[model samples]
Target chain A: MELLVFLIFAFLAVAAALVVVAHKNPVYSTMALVFTLFSVAVLFILLGAPFIGVLQVLIYTGAIVVLFLFVIMLLNIGREDSQIAGHKAQLFFALLGAVSFGSLVILALSSLRPKVLAPLTPELVSLKALASTLFNEFLLPFEIIGLLLTVAVIGATVAARRPTAEESAATAAERSIETKEARP
Target chain B: MNVDVVVTVAKIAVVLGLLLQVAPIMVWVERRGSAMMQDRPGPNRLGPFGLFQALADAVKFLFKEDVTPAAADKPLYLMAPALALLPAFTTSVVIPWGPNFTWDGKEYAFTVSNADTGVLLFLALASLGVYSLVMAGYASNNKFSLLGSIRASAQLISYELAMTVAVLAVIIPVGSFHLTDVVAYQRTNTWNCLLQPFGFLVFCIAAFAETNRLPFDLPEAESELVAGFHTEYSAMRFAAFFQAEYTSMAALSALGCTLFLGGWSLPWLNYEGMGWLGVALGLGTLLAKVGVCMFVFVWVRWTFPRFRYDQLMRLGWKFLLPVALLNLIAVSAMTLAGWL
Candidate 1:
């Protein structure tokens, strides 16, 4: 039963993800991508990490997808923009994605019963466990994540400022030219 | 109880067995709790104190005609509810209900599934459950359904970050991902809630968002989405969604209790008790803690106004995420200082 459910979800995740990239309508693609994310979260749950499963749902489905929707809504990027991407290029990308993903799947399956690297612990994998692991064992990565967050914040501010400032300056120059012509 | 028999029976019954039935009861509790909170009788008219209401509802659902709209994708539509529910039910496998029992001269540990990587597994399953909603909504091809599913999916994904970070906050102090160890760690002194109040707050809020309960229930916000992703669903398909939601709530509550409330440990009792009385007390403690948490779930559902879509996202990404990360740092510092 578990295996059956797992496979069904995996199929949905992979197929829906493909459709997300393949579809003509941006709305449809975004919606399909949501399904893809959800399917993966379900697979996580099946793996016995309900905490992570819930996180997958709350983060990917709840936040990231909403961000996608918000952008789609804000840009009002309709069917036209979705179709702007060339089909030939898309097909090539799709083929590449398929081959890479398929290879990974094959590799994972081939090592199904790989030697257990870590001893089994009867832990809940809740917030506490995550904290200990990140701070104690993965301390360097933890610090690096902090650095990454800082960079992301600064990068975002810089990106936003440059575009808006440039656009505003162009508008100002256009207005000045209009005024000079009127005075002349 | 010989260890071998115990293992065989538990493997069959506990892991994927009769214990699965508990999720359905959680559905009953949620309804009763919701109805009482609203100051109106919910399903009490159907049975004594409406205890059998869930059963009656199930029967009605099963007997109802399965409607497949002309425009719907038949295979995907049929598969969607199962997809939604399968992970919800499976997430409870690693929850430790009670301590190991040494009955009639043999030791038999009490837990459904004891995977070392159980927490990660749960997260993976839940992330995938979102597909069911997205598929159901998309497959229906109805605008309202699609809109609702999109909102819901987005909502779930956003909150997951804070939720994971909150879980991470608790995990850092203990140095283990095992539920048993978390519970044991809590049992020795303070419950996690007392020590990691910030993480607890974040976890509870994130839990609400994950379950898509009210205050975060934008997905099924009837005022907007018209039943959200499952708007077109009827009969058992619809019930499955509700069941999954409640079951997910129960699973979270169990986890919360185990993590924050010290699992099955009571404040008055030391860890040495090991007889039938001990089992009773331990199980009772667990039940009481879970019940309180579930009640809080209902209470918050009633008390708070649902957040706007943008506000909800902002809260998760902007506020909760930073708070969780900072709290994690504070916890690590404190643990290193031997203050905890």
Candidate 2:
């Protein structure tokens, strides 16, 4: 039953991911990507790492993907621009990207050891065990994650702080007016 | 084939049932609550002081025409509302609504989805709710819809960080990410609100903004953005957005119950096992806690005015994020010092 569920989830994840790339509209692509993230979260649960799965859904689907959509909307890059790249170079790059990612994934799957993990019993995979591992042995990584979050915030702020055209335009007008007055 | 399988399937059906019934009632409650707060009678004209208003609203929404703009990407536009509503429906799965019990010589757990990362699972499903708005807005090909989507995506993303960090704060001290465990933690000690006040505040604020509630509801500000992302959406499609918002609100409230109020935990109950009484008490406690949180959501919605867009962004970025990080640092320090 678990294997069947895992196969279903894996199929959904891959199918949704393909939609994200294949779709012409950026909005549709983003929506497909959201589904892809959700399917991945299900796969995570099947792997006995429910915490990571949920975090994947919450952070990536909820936060990062939303940011991507927001940027797309804010830039007002409408349907026309969001259509498939028409340039030959861009197509070549897209194909290259696909090949590279496919190779990496294939390599990772091939390297997987054949040993089966112990079947997850409810008692063995409860929140208590997850908590014990996270806080006790993984203390350093836990602490470092906090610092990493701070850095991410700072980075996002810096990236979003670039001056808009309106700002530059107003500054230019003001500078020209001052130059005219000074010369007189 | 097994008892667990039967029980899990039954639980999913129950959660779905509960969501369908509760979401509409939430709409009625919000309207009535807002009306009373503003010194006006709410939907008393419906049935029995607006008790049937939810039913009425549902009928109206169902009958409403499903509209698509002439220039809109028809397939994606039609798809957007369902996309929005689906994840919102899915989010309720992770909430531990009642208590586990042994009855008829069989053990049963009372939750929609019994994944070990209970609360985190809720967060993930909640986050996916954004795609609906983004898709609807983008597909509409309307400037107003686009603007609304931009505001929603940005607002939700900013608030999500603070929300996640705040969640981590409670998770750290409790030493568990499961909704059930978090509730258990609250039941054993004082509620999480009492123990982790700062984290509670952050979660509440982020929850409100994350759901696009006022004063954080800049995404669909009618005064400026003209209904925002759903501007082009009408009839049943628009109704999906409406239901999604209310459902998301309820899911967040359920989460609040699990994280801070204690899932299925009654106040003043003795922690030590007192037989069946303890089990009954735990279930009652969780329900009551969830009820209060839901009430607070409506109360807050009516009490505050909508925030300015820039101010909303600033609050998430400047105030909430900083406070969440600081709280995390403080909690870690306390742990290091053997204080917490």
Candidate 3:
């Protein structure tokens, strides 16, 4: 049953990934990306990472992709504008990159010993265990990453701050003068 | 089939039926409830006391023309309503509607799927609920719809952070994410609402925003956005969004009940070990709690005016988020001190 479920979702994930790249409309591509994310989430759940799986859907599909869709809608980019400028070259490079990545992954996996590993027990994937490992064993790295994220957020806010009052007024006057000049 | 499988199937059927039935009942309740508050008769033209008003509305929606706008994204437009409705209906699977009952020498839980990750699953599905609104707005190809969708995404994302923190506050004390375990903890101790009152308040406010109820309902501000993200939807498609809204309202109420209201447990009353009677009483208690919460939802909608977009954002981020974080810290400290 698990194998069957995995097969179905794996197929869906690949199909969705293909659609994400192949679809002409950006909105449709984004929707396909959602499907890919969802299928990957299901695969995670099947692999006994329920928490990660749910987080995948929660954070990626739910939050990140929604923002992507929001921007896509806000901009309302036409199909012609969204299409790749160098379509053939881009596809060729993408295929070459994918093949190299696949081969690299296969080589890495092949280097590992083919010993039979213990089955993933429920306790191993449980949130309690995951939380303990994350907080206790990897606390320093986690805290550092969190601090880095906070710094990044602060930097972004500072960078995106609105223009000062005088600058805004000057720009407004300039825009008004331009409009007035063009009106005739 | 095993008894577990059979029981689960039965539970799923019952839960789905109850959810489906509640949507219509809520529609009637909202109409009549609002009318009472407004001192006006509403929807009384249908069956006796307008009890059949929801049914009539359903029939009307079914018969109305399903118009697909020329400029709209056809597939996404058609898919949006169902997408919106899916999360609301599916999120109820984890809520324990009643205590376990021993029948035919086997214990059966009332919930459809009592997974260990129940709380996380609920949160995930609830977050995904935004997709429906966003898709509906964008696919409609209307400025109002797009604005509404944008508001919805922003509002939902902001409030969800506070909601998650508040839930974490409850979870810290219970030390579990399973809905049944949370209820079990409350059964032995005080309800989380009494323990974490501020967290409960934040959660309630966040729930209001998350479900897009009044005051925080900037996405669907009829006066401003003309029905918001669903501006272009009509007929049953429109009804689907309506059903999804009420269903999520019910689901959120159920979550609140489970987390803070001691679920099916009545205060000072132990319903366990009494077999079928206990289960029945527990189910009734849970239903009553959910009903009260739903009534509060409807009451707030009519009593309070909608907040400005800025105020809504301020309430979510500046006020609720900070307070919720503080509540979490306090709760965590208390738990660590072994006071909880």
- Top-scoring candidate (lDDT): 3
RMSD of 2: 5.0
| Fnat, one value per model | 0.17, 1.00, 0.59
Ranking by lDDT: 3, 2, 1
Candidate 3 is graded, for docking, as medium
- Give me the displacement of residue B230 in model 2, in angstroms: 1.7
Ranking by TM-score: 3, 2, 1
TM-score of 2: 0.83
lDDT of 3 by residue, A64-156 (tens): 888787778778776789866688988899899999999999999999998998788888889988999999999999999999999998999
Write candidate 1's Cα lDDT for B1-340 as tens digits.
5567667565457445433555566667767877888888877876678788778778899999978889887776888898888877777767777776776687655666665555655665565566677678767868788777777767777677777778877777777667877887887768999999999989888889988888988878888888888888998899888878877777778888887888888776764466767766776778778778877877887778888989988898888889998998999899899888
Query: Chain B, candidate 3: TM?
Result: 0.98
The CA lDDT at B271 in model 2 is 34
Q: Which ten residues in a row have the lowest lDDT in candidate 1 chain B?
A: B14-23
* Model 2 spans with C-alpha error above 4 angstroms: A1-7, A47-49, A82-184, B270-284
TM-score: which is higher, 1 or 3?
3
Task: Provide the overall lDDT of each model, using Cα atoms, as 2-decimal numbers.
Answer: 0.76, 0.80, 0.91
Query: Could you say which candidate leads in TM-score?
Result: 3
Docking class of 2: medium
The parts of candidate 1 lying over 4 Å away from their true place are A1-184, B1-35, B103-108
